[model samples]
Target: MLEVENLDLHYGQSRILYEVSFQAPKGQITTLIGNNGVGKTSTLKAIAGRHPASAGTITVDGTLVRLTTAFQAANAGIAYVPQGREVFPMMTVEENLETGFACLPKTDHHIPDHIYDLFPVLRDMKARRGGDLSGGQQ
Candidate 1:
């Protein structure tokens, strides 16, 4: 289960969230809905450790989580894929996928062919630099 309690977040002195709370039980889908400028993305960012929460406690299962950095969150098994896919400009698609090795065990370093099956264009463009791909391809 994921639980967020009395969450508060701010930018400089501009407060963005206050006492925001929610629960997402395991095996169930949860969605956040809000209009523009309502701190929706901020909430996800805080949970993903992309930004620090001013005050709050995030718990996964029953353990309190202190996400002080994005890498910490990722190591904790939380992934944040920003709206704009941020790929290495100089790396090829194959090389970009290979970078996932950093977050996995050496035994799992090989890229699975299923990924190429799912996105065949990536296989076709594996040698192309990430910066050269069209926006959709990225």
Candidate 2:
């Protein structure tokens, strides 16, 4: 399980999040829904360690996580597909997906077959640069 409690965030004294709390259990989908500027992305950023929270507790798999960086969150099994589909524009489709292996240990550093199953088009365009793909294809 992943848990967040009393999360507060600020950008140099301009507060963004306030007392946010939630829980996501394994094998379930948890969606964060809100109007614009309601802290949805901020909350994900905080959990993904892109930004530090002013006050909060984040727990994963019954262990308290001290999220000091985005890599740490990835190591803790937190995968973030940031807004705007931030794929590497300069790299090929295969290269872009290969970037995800950075979070895994060497023994597990290969793309899984299920990924191709999920995005079948990627299999055909593995040699094509990400920038050449349309926004919808991305």
How do all models score by TM-score? 0.85, 0.86
Off by over 4 Å in 2: none
Q: Give per-residue CA lDDT, model 1, range 9-128, as digits (tens).
A: 999999999999999999998999999899988999999988899998999888889897765786777777775689998999999989877767789889999999999999999999
Candidate 1 lDDT (Cα, 0 to 1) = 0.89
Model 1, residue 53: displacement in angstroms? Answer: 1.1
RMSD values for the candidates in order, in angstroms, are 1.9, 1.9
Question: Which candidate's TM-score is highest?
Answer: 2
lDDT of each: 0.89, 0.89
